[model samples]
Target: MTLRDFALMVVVCLIWASSNVVSKYVVSHLGVPPLFFAGVRFVLVALATAPWLMPAPKPLWRILAVGVLMGAGNFALLFIGLKTATPSSAAIVSQIGAPLTAVMSFLMLGETMNRRRIFGVSLTALGVILVMWDPRGFHASMGLLFVLAAAFLGSLGAVMMKQMDGVKPLQFQAWVGFSSAVPLLIASALFEPGAIEPAAAAGWRFAAAVGFSAIVVSVAAHTAYYGLIQRYEANLVSPLTLMTPLFTIGMGVLFMHDPFGPRMALGTIVALAGVLIVALRFNQLVSLVLAMRPRAQ
Candidate 1:
């Protein structure tokens, strides 16, 4: 990667990482309803990216569908989890999406999963199970289950995105911003009456959090991620995304003061290790590492 790519990746990682802290605050501090906040955030994102939607080509519909999974289902479930689960735990649980996606692709798309990927999926699933079982310092086991549901939806979206075409990354983000708003609004209306009034009452802090989510995190960070995919191989970009949860864990501890108990830590490590193993092709992984090693003078 060039310097610019490297810098962009760093920025994306930070923005995505901060999402956990911001989300925790929005749910815990501002008392915003999760589905309501997701709807509002995407509405802001749609407005922010409205110019791109006018042309609305046919290819965009599939993209929009994928966005609904990512933006609406993934986030709605995540927000539900956040209402009861801690930021750190949510981050760890949500990562199950990666391995889940791999397994789904193998089953649905007729893609083959080698031994390494299979092992990786098993480890990651076990890790998630461990984390779910512990619930040590965190509250709401049911909430964690909701977050896992969100991760599954996200994995489905990821798989769908692979089959999609003609949509740029930014365009994808914009459509998601647009499509995600509808379901979220519907859910909010049904489940979270008086949602907007409370958000308005909460004032700019709430607004700012929503704005950052829409503009900075959803729009900018995702744009960079798609951009990276354009520049590098999918395998390379995919593994690096692991950094996102790691960063989220850090932000949760430092910014949100989420407690990191032994169980959570161990679970995270085990889960991440599983994901890493699955993500990297064993022979290719060895070659890549050897290539990266410094040579003797």
Candidate 2:
């Protein structure tokens, strides 16, 4: 991990974090339809990365499935959630994807779950519950529920991706863009009638947001992150991504005026801590977890 690479990773995290705020603004504030917004973003992503689609990965069916799950399914739900969920709370809730991936791996990939991982998973769930707690009950936080579902789909896609081979980041992005765009566009047309009107009203702002999200965040930042993954160890790179939600929470406060009371703060800390635990490798994780336990006399 050179200092430059670390800086690059931080930049990548910032880009990703800003995306939440951007999406929230476009959907919640600008009034763009969520499915329509996601569909257009993927359409642009597909065009940009279309060249990489060649020499397509095998098991095309699985690739398509992963694409829809990670790309359209995940982001469509996220945008929908952002319609009502603040970026700050949504960011904290999204951290559940890390532990969800771990659990999915255990269930689908025959992976082992040690004490640390189990504890981490439990903590993550607890944190999400705390963050989602509403005195007004579930109806008030329906958006967060959608976000949770999105996280589950994304985690499932990640677990499925582990079985894939020879799929470069750009190539994967290309497939995801193409596969996700079709269904999303169709769904938007069907369910969100006159979706284009709001986008038209938004004009260049909408185009700019979608372009930034598609090209810069999805294509460029993700490709750079994947390059780092190839260069560095996964455990090292993975934990650093926790910076994303922190950045999102900060940006949400500064830009969106999102409320951040004590409960939200505590939930963020606990959720991020759990994700950090889940991201750690076996040796480091065991040592940390063991240290936390009371010493026997």
Candidate 3:
């Protein structure tokens, strides 16, 4: 990668990783309902990109649909997961989306899943189960399940996006922001009832989170991510994104001061390893390395 691309990757990582810590802040300090927070974030994002929303979506609506699932549904669920789950745990669960996408492609798109991919996916699921099964607290249940749901929706959206063409990332994000916010607001209203009032009472701290989430996390991070996609193949780019969780785990530990017990540590490793296997089989790794290696004289 060029220096420019490398720096962009770091920026992408920072934006993606910072989201976990910021979401934790919104939930813990502002006491905003997770879905409501997400709604606010997407609404801001939509407004920011409103000028671009015109222009024919046409067949591109299919691609925009994926963005909705990924941007709104995935984020909404992830925030809710964080409400009761640790940032580290939520990071790990979100990684499950990669493996889930692979499984989904095989089922929905009729893609062939080699044995390595299958094994990797299976291990990934097992790791998630172990991490979620925290003999105490809300483990193996709401906290874990919500994050997993986030992963599933995100993965599904990714798969759908892959099949479409011609939609720019910014355009896609704008549509996603609009599509996602409505459902999120409805869900927040029904479930949390007082969601908006508390956020209003809290004021700027909550407002800052919404701003950061929309401008920095969504726009900046995703723009960098899309730039990377322009330079690299999806397979190459996607696997490295797994690193986001690691960064998230670190942020959770250092900034949030969330627990980093042996269980969480072990679970993270196992889950990451599984996701790697599923997403980047040994053969793919070998091919990538060989491609990058200098040719012999």
lDDT scores of the candidates, listed in order: 0.84, 0.95, 0.82
Order of candidates by lDDT, top first? 2, 1, 3
- Candidate 3 lDDT over residue span 1-297, tens digit each: 678876778768877888888997888667888988999898898898877776747676675678678987888888887877888888887778878888889988999899988888888887787678777755345876888998889989989877877778788778888788888888888988988898999888888878988999888788779979988877777777877888988888899887778877787888888887876758887886798799989
TM-scores vs. true structure, each candidate: 0.92, 0.95, 0.90
lDDT by residue (tens digit), candidate 2, 1-297 = 899999999999999999999999999999999999999999999999999998878899899999999999999999999999999899999999999999999999999899989999999888998899887787888999999999999999999999999999999999999999999999999999999999999999999999999999999999999999999989989988999999999999999999999888888889988898888967877775797799989
Ranking by TM-score: 2, 1, 3
The number of the candidate with the highest lDDT is 2
Model 1, residue 61: distance off in Å is 5.7
Which candidate, 2 or 3, has the higher TM-score? 2
After superposition, candidate 2 runs with Cα above 4 Å error: 282-297
What are the per-residue Cα lDDT tens digits for candidate 1 across 1-297?
788887778779888888888887898778998989999999988888887876674776667778899899999989878887887888888888888998889877888888888888889988887778843443447889999999998988888887876767666777888899988999899999988887888899998999999889988888878888888988777777778888888888888788787878888999988887877878868876798899999
lDDT of 3 at 27: 82
RMSD of each: 2.4, 3.8, 3.3
User: Model 2: how far is 157 from its true place, Å?
Assistant: 0.7
Query: Which residue window of length 10 is worst by lDDT in model 3?
Result: 135-144
